[model samples]
Target: MNAILTVLEIVAPVFLVGGVGFAWVKAGFEYRIQFVTRLAMTLAVPCLIFTALMKTEADLATLGTLAVAGSLGYFVIGLAAWVILRLAGLDMRTYLAPFIFGNTGNLGIPLCFFAFGQVGLEAAVVMLAVSAIWSFTIGIWMVAGKGSGGKILKEPMIAATLLGALFLWQGWETPRFLTNTLDLIGQMAIPLMLITLGVAVARLTPGRITTALWLSVVKLAICTAVGWAVGTAFGLTGAIFGVLVLELATPVAVTAYLLAEKYEADSNAVAGYVMVSTLTCVIGLPLILGFLL
Candidate 1:
């Protein structure tokens, strides 16, 4: 029962902040989702990643292990999802990326912070960096029929991760004033992302929602299992293990719908995945957290 309450404490703020965005959109507020997302991703999120990496006292070896475990988890999930989709006769372009890449950034980061504090955030950031690198490169290729290797070079988060990793390795710190300013900027990332997520979901037009529902269930099970198994194999315990599973099991990203739309795939269908999977997680994530706790 204490575990249940702890799960609630961790997840309540996440959902509440997201609910605020949903309500804002429903109330006919001007959200400017694209602008907020851009700010969060290009500026706020990068700063957050940089600062988190720079300041975290997590052992370098542990961070490295989490990074490796995260990469393996994604690879296994991709292979498994590919097989499932092909057998189910679904459109690979539309379904594969969503299955392979969960919302490790917008949702995963804050949830980890709430659940496990700074240590969780440190581990979660590593997972996010792994997911982002792959999503921008390999995940894009699956959707667009061409790899976006260029995007890897262009993304600020990628740069931040590399620079942060360098600092972590070298035990360097930015000037105090600069660190404080960046920290302030980074503080906007979580709330901005949560609110933007609500705005984006509110704006989506779902298609084949029933199909999406089943797919969401299956995806959740697969991801939870795979993340658990991989973390166990790596001998990960406590917060790191929980984080690996939680980050891998986040709902389908709103960005997947946007990507489908941008690439002229089945945008409405992808919207269903985004909508139902996210909504399903309202219950699903908590249960997972309950178990982890």
Candidate 2:
């Protein structure tokens, strides 16, 4: 009971924050969501990635495991999603991106923090960073028809990952002042994202709920099964095990919808999947945690 409540306590705010954002837009406070999301993408998200990579200690071997496992897990599930989506005749960018790109960074990071404290947080941070790079580079090819040279060149997440990798190779110690500033900015990403989600929810029409539920089930059930199998087979233990499953089991990211919207993909399908997956996490994450924890 306590565990359940703890999970709820952490998760409920995401919905609540998202609901507020949705309501504001419906009530004519439209500009706030855009402003917050842009701030998160341009400043806070980069800061978060930089600070997390700079601060987390890395062993080449373990980092390799994390990268391999995380990437493989994503690839397996993402491939499955593509097959299912294609068979179901839902082969649009809107539908596919959410299925492929689950909420790895935002919800996944915080959940890892709760599940494993610093150790889990450390593992998740590395995986999230890696996954973010994967989404824009390899992942863009999978979803967006053909990858655009301009899109790849201009992506901030890609730039951040490359710079982080370079710094890692060079053994650079992040300056204290820069780290502090980035930490402050990075702190804003999660809440702002949640609020933006709320605003999106508020704008949901009456007919959207059914599709959301279907995608939610696919996102949670398929990914969780695949993740657990991979983690257990790989003999992942403790926080590493938990982080792998939970992050994979996370809902479809709202950014899938945003990207779909920006790229003129199937935004409606992406939005439906994101909403459904987010709601499904309320039920799915607790169940996974209950069994594992």
Q: In order, what is each prediction's RMSD in angstroms?
A: 0.9, 2.9
TM-score of predicted structure 2: 0.84
Global CA lDDT computed for model 1: 0.93
| TM values, all candidates | 0.98, 0.84
The top-ranked prediction according to TM-score is 1
- Counting only residues 3 or more apart in sequence or on different chains, how many pairs clash (N, Cα, C under 3 Å) in candidate 1? 0
Which ranges in model 2 have alpha carbons more than 4 Å from their true place?
26-30, 58-60, 92-94, 165-171, 204-209, 262-264
Please, what's the RMSD in Å of model 1? 0.9
Per-residue lDDT over 1-293 for candidate 1, one digit per residue giving the tens place of the 0 to 100 score: 78888889999999999988999999999988878888898999999999999999988889899999999999999999999999999999999999989999888999999999989988888999999989989999999999988878888988999999999999999999999999999999999988888888888899999889999999999999999999999999999999999999999999899899999999999999999999988899999998898
